[model samples]
Target chain A: MKRLLLLLAFAGVVALMAWGFNQAIFVAPTEATMGDVQRIFYYHVPNAMLSFLFFAISFVASILFLAWKNSAPERAQAADAWALASAEVGVVFCSVVLITGPLWARPVWGIWWTWDARLTTTLILWLIYVSYLLLRRFAEGAQMQTLAAVLSIFGALDVPIVYMANRWWRTQHPAPVFGGGPDSGIKDPTMLAAFGWNVLAWAAWGLMLLAFRVHVERRQQRIRHHQTVAALAGK
Target chain B: MSGMNDNSGSQNSSSKNSSSKKSSLKNSRSLRIVVAVVVVLGTIGYLAYTGQASAKSYYVTIPEMQKMGAKAYSSNLRVEGFVKPETIQQDGPNVRFVLSEYESHNPKAQQNPRQITVDYRGSEPPPDTFKNDAQALAIGTWGQDGVFHATQLQAKCASKYAPAQGAATSGAKVATNEAPVVAHGNRTN
Candidate 1:
């Protein structure tokens, strides 16, 4: 049953990824002027959004872990595992966002990068999560969890501020191209359909990765706790 | 007997809490050092990235450019203003014109726009029918010597190019026969 469940999950992820790839790079129409390369938006924007979301969740989970006053070693360990999963996924999504965003920007904005708020905040968000991972490696046990949680909260606070800074200052990054933004033209039906499907596919991909990472984290915690208990017994 | 059991339960809970606290603190000061370093390095790295970005030029409108004056406007610039109808002179391969400046925040000012001269040395401009009074952007440089040299020119194409929502239209390329206004000395090739 376990093997079957794993197989179904893997197949689902593969299907979602294939659909996402088509929506992102294949089926989307070429931009009128840029010609054939504007489809990178589907991957770049979604990954960027997901990276921010994972980090935000890490922050909330950390807060709950610290505040709930749970005394069981298992509870603390589970929270650490969640932190680990969030940090890993956050890093992956941030990397994808960084890479694909530059590819999209080069053709349209005519520069590989700008000092725009979204870009800057994203870089900061990436660093914050990298720090979370490094903190995990260097600090272990209860204190490590507490410190990571505090940092996660701090990092999440930066997201809104970063988004706001774009409007507060001059930005080179294009504003919303779809949705209800003031500059957004009406999206044609075909484009809208592609965008909707891509969003669903991306969500599936993110959830699949999150599930895998969380599973590994739980396993690691179990092993580590067993080792600690063995060591105490030996002493 | 009930009271005794309740007291023992309270003691067990208190002992568990103290034990967890003791375990957490018993981890050596080395853990504290690690946290400090990560926080410090993370903060420094984030600040450095933000600082480098802030030093780069942000996009500015033509009015913003005007406000920035000669000293502050140095990095690659994108200026949007109105095409000055009279200042537009098509000289051979180069077109020279002025962009009428306006506040960057006011898109409504596009209707009664001032003109700026753009000298584009590219292939022929998009089309002759392109409006003389349209909002435009000249993507290039404003020299320290105070002239703007444009490599590209774009006049915002309005709804005139397309048929309204449900109208059927046949495709036919129309000829645009505009008189050439070459500059006095540079009309070769």
Candidate 2:
């Protein structure tokens, strides 16, 4: 039954993605200045949003893990697993944003990359999370979990900076589309609709991926516990 | 009775051993948490201080750049200004243009404005939005020959979004100047 549910969810995600792509390519009107290249915004913005969402989740999970460490070890362990899962998934989405951003910028901004505030802050955010993942891989034992949780808490400080970079400083990057004052929003209704569809699809897909990753992490922890028990019995 | 005492003694020793091991584990865990907290706090403090310092050196406007005088020539600066009308000369992928300190929405505002020449020899061709009276930000340093030698050029589309406060509104007229560049397509050199 669980397998059937998983398959159905996967199929739904695939269908939504296909429909979103259709809307982006056909239903949305071409931008006045950028024309076809502006279509990349549908994917790029959603990926960036999802990445931020995932990192936020990781931050909360890390806090919960630390808070529950002494009072309830089991809950702490669960939080630790969740933090790992979310960080890993966040990095994947962040990678998408980084890659697609340059592609869209090349034709529109006439450059593949620029060291503006927004771009630089985003790059730093990605590096911080990548280092978080590496810490988990290299560190061992319960200490590893504590160290990783600490790193995640520190890494999350970059998310707010990244989100506010464009607003706080002058950059070649475009200003925020959402809440960027009265003049900064999509004028076309169809483009907005396409953006809505793509954002929903990507968010759903990201949640599904997070769920699967957490499950795998739990299984690995159980396996490790079993191995320890077996070794102790042999001794 | 003796057997019973021996069994109880063994049980006491086993419990004591387990208790000691558990206490040691707890001690180490608490120690690790303290160290982790210190390291994390130190890192956050360092990053916050450095991030603030770097953010302070953000882009300067044309008037501000001139105010710095000799200091502007030494520091790598981003200068924001309006593209002077009819001053854009394109050669292959390289572009030479003039920037003015006028922030007016009117294209005629280019007349008699304080101007500076810019030579853009970046890897990418100028964007289609690059045109007369557009708002531009040039990232590079001032050269010895009284020109801004830009390593990067960015042209804002005025019609799509409102120009930032103090930036010229001439960007709105860029649509008319965009046709020729779109036909040529952006080239990277």
Candidate 3:
């Protein structure tokens, strides 16, 4: 029954993604100024928003892992698993954002890149999380999880800085298309609809990926536990 | 009694020697720590100072640029202003244009504003979005000739991404309704 439920969820997500893609391409009006190039916005913005969300989940999980370390070892391990999974997924989504952003910017901004605060801060965020993932991979000894969890928290802090980069500074990047004061936001309902659908689809997809990663990590942890038991018995 | 005094005097000297050695070691370690701290702080201070210096203002407005006097002419800087109508003169990748404090998008904001002439030469053609009423940011040095000599130029569309007039206002539901029909046709093919 659980497997069937998971299958249903997967099917639902695929359908949502297809629907969102259709909305973005066909339903959204071509932006008057940018024409077809503006379609990239539907993809880039959603990926960026989802990256922040996954990082936020990772941050909370890390905090919980730290809090439960001594009192409940099992719970701490579970939280640590969650931290690693979400952070890895977050980096994947952030990579998409980083790649898609340059693709969109090259044509629109005329230059492939700029060192504006928004772009610089986003690059830093990606680097921070990439380092976090690396720390998890190669770190040695008992305190590895603790160290990684702390780094996860540090990485999560960059999310807010990335989000507010444009708001706080004058940048080559444009102001927010949504919630960017008055004169900002989608002028047309159709574009807004397309944007809304893409955000929902990408978010659901990211969450699904996070769950699968966590499940795999838990299994690995159990295997490690069994190996340790065997080693103790041998000794 | 003499033998006991000799042993006691030697013991006191050795004790004094070890105490001095320990004190010297502690002093050297503290000096090393102080040097390390100063180096770390100096690096941080240098980075912060330079980071703020470059990033403090992404671009200066035409009015502010004008007020800067000779200082503006000396350094590489970015100045943003709205492109004046009918003033674009294109020369391959290089262009001559006039920018004004009067934003072409919001005419109601100012009737007449300050103006500046810019000369831009770039390796690539000016961006497609460059046009009359567009906001342009020119990065280079200001010149004594009253023309801003620019090595890099960037433009923002005057419309700023408002949808085109035709089908943009149509209901989203109506468009999606047609999407399935197109998909089904493609499947048959």
Candidate 4:
């Protein structure tokens, strides 16, 4: 029954994504300045948004891990597992944002990349999460969770900076479409609807990925515990 | 067998308790490391913040660039203006053009608006969108010799996306004929 539920969720995500893809290409009107290449905005913005959401989740989980470390070790372990899973999933989405951004910028800005405030901060955000994942992979035993949790907290500080980079500085990257000021915003209703659909679909998919990753981490912990017990018996 | 299982379970709990104590000790040491890491990251963040602030260049109009006078000549800057009709000259691999504060197509704005000569000698060729009356931004330093020696050039066609003036209901249609602007070069300011 659990397997069936997982399968159903997977199917739902695929269908939603397909609908989003159709909306982006066929339904949304082409942007005046960028034409069809602006279609990448549908995928790029949502990926960046979901990545930020996942990093925020990791930040909270890391705090919970540390807060519960002594009083509730089991709860702390669960929080640690959650932190790891969310950070990994966040990095995957961030990578997609980074890649799609350049593809869109190439035609619009005439350059593939720039060290503008927004772009540079986003790159740093990706790097910080990458470092968090490395700490989890190579660091040893109980100390590893503590160290990884600390890194997650540190890494998450970049999230707001990335979002505000464009607003605070003059950048080649366009201003925010939603809250950007008098000069900026989506003028077309269809464009807004398409962007909304894409964001919802991607967010749902990201949540599913996060849940599966957390489950996998818990199962690995159980297997490791069993091995430790067998080794103690032999000794 | 049940008794044996109970004995192992108790053994596991005791081991877990002892290990947890050990972990708490290690946690203190890890906390110190975390403090050190935070200090390093904080310093880096501070330096980056200041550096970006000092390096940021405002997008000034041609008139504003003149108002900047000698300061504009020294500092890195970006200026947006419309390309003057029939003023573009190809200089070997380089291109030179005149940028006006007002659109050349606007017959009523100013017959001869404030203009600046831009000599683009960057690594990449001028984008196909670089044509008469195109809105363009030049990123580089203004030479004392009076020309803006642009290391990078970006151009956007004016008629491409007619953004509705005041009416919230007016729809925008993408222009079909123009080639997409291509920005090339490693020069970033």
DockQ of each: 0.09, 0.12, 0.17, 0.13
How high is the lDDT of residue A218 in model 2? 91
Q: Write the per-residue lDDT of candidate 3 for residues A1-235, one digit (tens) a residue.
A: 9999999999999999999999888778766556566788889989998999889999999999988988899999999999999999999989998888888777666787888888998999899899988888888544999989878887787777688777777788887876776545677777878889999999889899989999999999999899899999995
Q: Candidate 1 chain B, which ten residues in sequence have the lowest lDDT sum?
A: B167-176
Calculate the i-RMS of every candidate, to one decimal place: 11.5, 10.0, 9.5, 7.8
Task: Enumerate the chain B TM-scores of all models.
Answer: 0.44, 0.53, 0.57, 0.53
Which digits, one per residue and each the tens of the lDDT, describe model 4 over residues B1-189? 576556656776877577667768989988997899789789868966885765445477888789987799788888888788789998765889999887654664466688989999978777655666667889999998889999988764331221122211232233223333233211111
Residues B1-189, candidate 2: write the lDDT tens digits.
577556656777877577668868989988997897787677866766676666545577877888897898899988888787678899888899999887444455547666799999988778876776666878899988999999888775432422122212223234323332132111111
Q: Which ten-residue region of model 1 chain A has the weakest summed lDDT?
A: A29-38
Q: Report the number of backbone clashes for model 4.
A: 1
Q: Give the 10-residue window scoring lowest on summed lDDT in candidate 4 chain B.
A: B180-189
Task: For model 2 chain B, give the 10-residue run with minimal summed lDDT.
Answer: B180-189
> Which sections of candidate 4 miss by over 4 Å?
B1-95, B100-115, B128-135, B155-189
Q: Give per-residue lDDT, candidate 1, residue B117.
A: 53
Candidate 1 residue-wise lDDT, A77-167, digit = tens? 6676676787788789889988987776654444567656668877888888889889988878778788888788777777765555544
Clashes of each: 12, 0, 0, 1
In model 3, how large is the Cα lDDT of residue B121? 90
Q: Is the docking of candidate 4 incorrect, acceptable, medium or high quality?
A: incorrect
Taking all chains together, each candidate's TM-score versus the true structure is 0.67, 0.77, 0.81, 0.76
Residue B53 error, candidate 2, Å: 7.7
CA lDDT, candidate 1, residue A86: 79
Per-residue lDDT for B1-189 in model 3, tens only? 577556656787877577668769979977996796587568646654665565548889888888888899898999988778789999899899998876555654267778889999989877766776666788999889888999988874321345554546563344333321111001000
Interface C-alpha RMSD, model 1: 11.5
